[model samples]
Target: MEFDLSWILLGLPLAFVLGWLASRFDLRQLRAENRQAPKAYFKGLNFLLNEQQDKAIDAFIEAVQNDPDTSELHFALGNLFRRRGEYNRAVRVHEHLLSRGDLGPADRDRAQHALALDFLKAGLLDRAEEALKPLEGTAFESEARLALLAIYERSRDWPQAAAITRKMQASGQGDFSARQAHYLCEQATAASAQGDEATAHTRLTEAMAAAPQAPRPRIELARQQHRQGQPGAAVDTLATLAAQAPGALPLATPLLIEAAAAAGRSAEALALLGRHYEQMPSLDLLEGLVALDRASGDATRPGRNRYVEHLAKEPSLVAATQWLATEQLEHEQFHPQIQRALDQAARPLMRYRCAACGFEARQHFWQCPGCQTWDSYPARRVEEL
Candidate 1:
């Protein structure tokens, strides 16, 4: 019934030997796992470099399986899936990272951003918006705000777009004053459509105050004034615009002529247009001058003569076509066919073009419908460019 001291001494050494063996086995296993993970990672990288996305994804999945705690591997896998248009897989991977309680603040934000990108790429706008809103004060704030701005613009949510632009302005991201003006103009258009003329005018006024240098609000305001039987007000607005943004005179010329004719100030409008045309000879300005001269009963100089005069400044096909219409031709019967061909050739040259994306349109745009860029289209026409 006595404890054996011999047994205790024997067991102590035996236990130490067994513990050493187990520790050695664990060390070997850990080394093997470490080597395997890196091997898989490098294999994935090689596949990625070779542009074999499918193979790279397989390798990355193997690496992630080999090292579940490797956040970088998970990120790579998620991004690969996202790029491969595997939104469900990308969302799941990012969501899994977010679910981990051991993740640091920065990694958590990254996971959230990745999740938002997945939703955005998948066209799940509502989900993307929900995911992105949480990244407001994070490092991804600017990118998130821009993405949100695009979403609002695409959806035509003017109020939300305006709010986002204001936030971007306050953060010193960029000057969104012009964009803010566009949003107000959009709101004004909506108000005008609803027969709320007072509200429309107020919004347009706010828009003009927001970006005094912007042309859209003033142009829109003038159009509204003309519609409301305020021709003098419209002419005054366009005259101010011509002074402020002389380059935009081409776009405003047609409106100015109409307003001036309505207000009985055709002579003053013609002088203003001529002054700008002298500085920058725009086809639109030349056309405006011709229209005004013809309307004023000035037979001393024909409108066709203005096209001939414009030809002296620039070799415009449009101008030549116009001049050919009234010129004395030896074969007057063939003039119709020749003029038709010239008109067809000059029509495309008369289109307004986007400076950003090269999207040509018959009319000028404040924003590019193709690239979703604001003020991408120049004030001048394609031929002028």
Candidate 2:
């Protein structure tokens, strides 16, 4: 049992040598793995900066595989997939991130938001709504609510849209009173279509109270009153609209003139319209005045004279054509053809144009069909603008 000390000392050095070699090997392997991960990540970033998305995606996938537990890499890859319109892949990536037990609260919320965006981009409204609901009180709450509002609007769910607008208003996310009024107006329109005058009236009244400065509510309310055999009330509502939002009077000029005729208040309507035209010389206002003048049997300030007056103020092809239509030309044989050509040229100038997107329409729209922007079209026509 008496062993030699030489054997013990010899075994110790050999074991130490093996341990050092193994440590060096492990260090080299770790360094190589770290290098590969960074190399792939930087390569992906370079590809992205160069606008080579496909190559960037391949590099990102390689980077993610090399470092599977990296949350940032997962986010980048998920966002890239979403940008590429690969919603299914984006959803999977974000869902996998959400499923990870080690992920932090913020990261989980981000993943949830990303998943919601993927659903929204894929035109899955129901799924997007479901995914976005849990993000309340988080940093992504505002964005989620806006997306939800847009979805509700797209689906014509005015009540939901109004509720979201209220919440956004309470949170100091800018004034949404205008939008709230629009929603109520939309709801009122639907009610009126279904022959529910009481509900429509209530909604329109609420809309006016919600945003008195908003022109759409008053205009809609006036229309409702006029349709319900209350022309006097309609005139009063429109008069209030003109006083409150003078810029919007042109949009309701025809209705105003009709209501004035129905209510037998042509003199007051003429005065109000003339004052407005004096302040703002819109073609619509001029047309309203001319219609009332022609109907009044007053030869002094004739309807055609107003066109001549408008021409003196500003050169308008529309005004010139209207004035010429009543003139006794020396060469009257081709008058019809000349009138037709002039009318055709003047028609486009009478169309309204959207301020936000430059979309033109023969009739004004509260919301632009082209850009989906509310109150984009001004009351003035393309010529006036």
lDDT of each: 0.94, 0.94
Question: For residues 1-385, what per-residue lDDT tens digits would candidate 1 score against the true structure?
Answer: 9998999999999999999999999999999999999999999999999999999999999999999998999999999999999999999999999999999999999999999999999999999999999999999999999999988998999999999989999999999999999999999999999999999999999999999989989999999999999999999999889888788878988999999999999999999998999999998999999899989989898888899889999989998998898897998989999999999999999998988888889988888989989999888888888
Q: Could you give me the TM-score of model 1 versus the true structure?
A: 0.96
Window of ten residues with lowest summed lDDT in model 1: 243-252
Off by over 4 Å in 1: 1-13
**lDDT tens per residue, model 2, 1-385:** 8879999899999999999999999999999999999999999999999999999999999999999999999999999999999999999999999999999999999999999999999999999999999999999999999999989999999999988998999999989999899999999999999999999999989998999899999999999899989999999999999999999998899999999899999898999999999988989999999999999989887799999999999999999999999998999998999999999999999998999999999999999999899999988888887
Q: What are the runs in model 2 whose C-alpha is more than 4 Å off?
A: none
Worst 10-residue lDDT window for candidate 2 reads 376-385
lDDT of 1 at 133: 100
